[model samples]
Target: MSRRTDNRHRVATICRRATGLTHDTCLRWAADGLITRQRPVPDAGTPQQRAFEARLFAELAAGAVLGLTGIRPARAEPALALHADRAREVLDALLPRLDGTGALRGVPGLRLVPDGGSWWLTDLVDRVARVRLLHPRPGWGPRPGPTARQDGGRDPLWRTHRHALHPAEAALLYGRAKEDGASWDRDLLFSRTLRRLRLIVDAGAQHGWVRLDTTGAYDLVIECCCASGALKLMHGLRQSALAQERDDEGPGYSGDIDVGGACVAVRHASCGSFPQPVAGPDLRWVTC
Candidate 1:
């Protein structure tokens, strides 16, 4: 039927067509700001119904904009396109250097490292890409804690930890050189990197393998956050370097280890209201 000929029919049709909303539901949505009326209703019969239908269509449009609509487009292309391209470039450059056994036996700038008896860059590129696609936000919620730790004075291991990235991730996000200036690309990279680091921390905590303690000579310690477990290995390397320095310089070098490079901060919070779930390992052994 021609919409102009029957106003009620037109209104009902648009309401149902746009949002699959009933006439009454459309009216509620309109009142709730979920939708808006297209035009002023006539001062006659069915005015309320006409207003309701207009609002329904508006709500439906809003739904589409907020990605709440069922008919939204697939996210593969628009969300992760750039990330996928960069990952491909990094892999292409690094993969060729692997030995005949698919091991990074001899590669410059990139080396094959081991973690949990496995070999992988912890698939960091993929981790960064996935995090960017899912959460393009500035910060993450608090990490979860054990149910027993809900009350005060829980062990430090049950606390939530927050961390910022190191130079490599920051460089990718803010651009290799500062003079290149800010752009959407840099913003996306920075946001993605933050999200990825949070995820990495969470995953490590869940496995009960990650530890953050400053009691040792080092000011900050990060264990098991790298792709090849390089973070842990790096800690050993630093200790070795310090030992060598001490041996060469004698007892005069009785100073604090200057490991004050950037590290994720771990702090205790009440477990009852933690913002997110904590998965993986039990970290109770590592005192904060």
Candidate 2:
């Protein structure tokens, strides 16, 4: 379905607000191709299109942040794209946790590291565990019994953690031309600018997270809403099939998985999906 959204916020204004950059600076970045010209959405556009714009905003702000940090236009644009691509990968697992108005209700903070780094995105939250309930149907009367498969077990039913990616502990690499042993400029302008951008991102202004009012106008909520809808549809089909199983019926069933916003359907060749289910390894304990 299509909805009408406010289109009056200028791109430069958003950039300025996100990174504290002057309007002129943002315009220069746009002119120099640091900020690619994202397609404009009409007042009434599909939810998906609006969601796309919200995603674009992240790249735009990231580019401006990179540029202001003294990275040249050529390097900044592609770097921003890489960051956005990685962020998009986990959105399907993310969207269900958001509240109706797109505000983050009870999500935890995330820790994200820049690309080409050791920890690009942090591991899943440790406190909680996920399990899938499975029932086996026999030929006689009711199914054999039900079994529980925890996450990482062949396949487990999944639910999202309502966590915000803010207050994120992040580390970004700043490539320097100076020799490894030599002292580099610690107080470079770009270094200062990068720190400022980090603050905005942490506070949820740059990426529009956590806070209620601004979040409705920015990335996480809108993008999450659209993407979450698709994910719900995919899970719904598989869940419905599982809910209707009777003991007299066969052992297998068709299941769907959400991958990059699209549904991929799979079926088992033998009795059913995971007939002889193999349990995954146990979680290893680690101290931070």
Candidate 3:
């Protein structure tokens, strides 16, 4: 066996050699509470911590050599589940609040369900969830449709006023988008909706109609508009107070507002939209 030059060579050197990541990166990870390091007590230390450090080093080194950092991105599995559970709870608390005269009062007649699939109803649920996350109360409205004419003609009425679109109108818009080849991928769709939701919250807060609270939920106050002909749309939103915090604590918001009117219908027309609101038998009418 070769002679060991020093104890440092055995531990720190081995760690650096095994991980392929820079010594600083390893140390940073350790400092950030991501990885733990062990030091022998003059002669002995915890074997578990030592093993973990060695394994992490080795994995990093291997990743470097293969140009494949085996480290998976951090995820919030437990937090996500918790958020989903909380979403269900919040939904339960919200439906009753929708009963009286207001934007939500029209939901019963629209056959709203808990499922995130119906266009108008899902929009409503999403708006509520968003408000709950941003302020104490939640609200959302239809996104404006394309101003330019498409090859088929002006976009459908539903596309222009999804919030106001009837079932028949939604069906027509869905067919049109499918025909035009404008639908996006799941990841893209989620990202777009998230951005749009933020903008809506900001606009409402600025107008003094809503307030985005510390928990990311909103406090909403609906005002009656005399414009009876204006189309109304609802949004279905999901917020996770337990998951992550907003990046900044500024009074302003950033990001694009182009949440594609074309793709919104795909979410609006599905079955998941309505059933997501009511719990049991109360769901019958909404589902129908």
TM-score, every prediction: 0.17, 0.19, 0.19
Which wins on lDDT, candidate 1 or candidate 2?
Answer: 1
Query: How many backbone collisions does model 3 have?
Result: 50
Model 1 misplaced stretches (Cα beyond 4 Å): 1-175, 178-207, 211-239, 242-256, 259-288
> Number of the top candidate by TM-score?
3
Ranking by TM-score: 3, 2, 1
- Which candidate order results from sorting by lDDT in descending order? 1, 2, 3
Residues 1-288, candidate 3: write the lDDT tens digits: 233223333333323332233456544444454432242101102232222222222222211111111111111100011121233332222221222221221111122232232111223212321111211123322234543223234433223344555454355436644774333332233322222232222222211122111112211111111111001112111111100122222222221112222112211122222223333333223221
Worst 10 residues of 1 by lDDT: 69-78
Q: Which stretches of candidate 2 lie over 4 Å from their true place?
A: 1-14, 19-25, 29-47, 51-150, 153-288
Better of 2 and 3 by lDDT: 2
Worst 10 residues of 3 by lDDT: 73-82
Q: lDDT for model 2, on a 0 to 1 scale?
A: 0.26
User: How well is each residue in 1-288 modelled by candidate 2, as lDDT tens digits?
Assistant: 112111222443334443444667655655454442241110112222222222222433432322222111122111121223233323322222233443332212222323332222222343221111111222211111232222222111122222422222111112222326312121121222221232223333222221111132121211111233323322332221212221122332223322222222322121121112135322123111
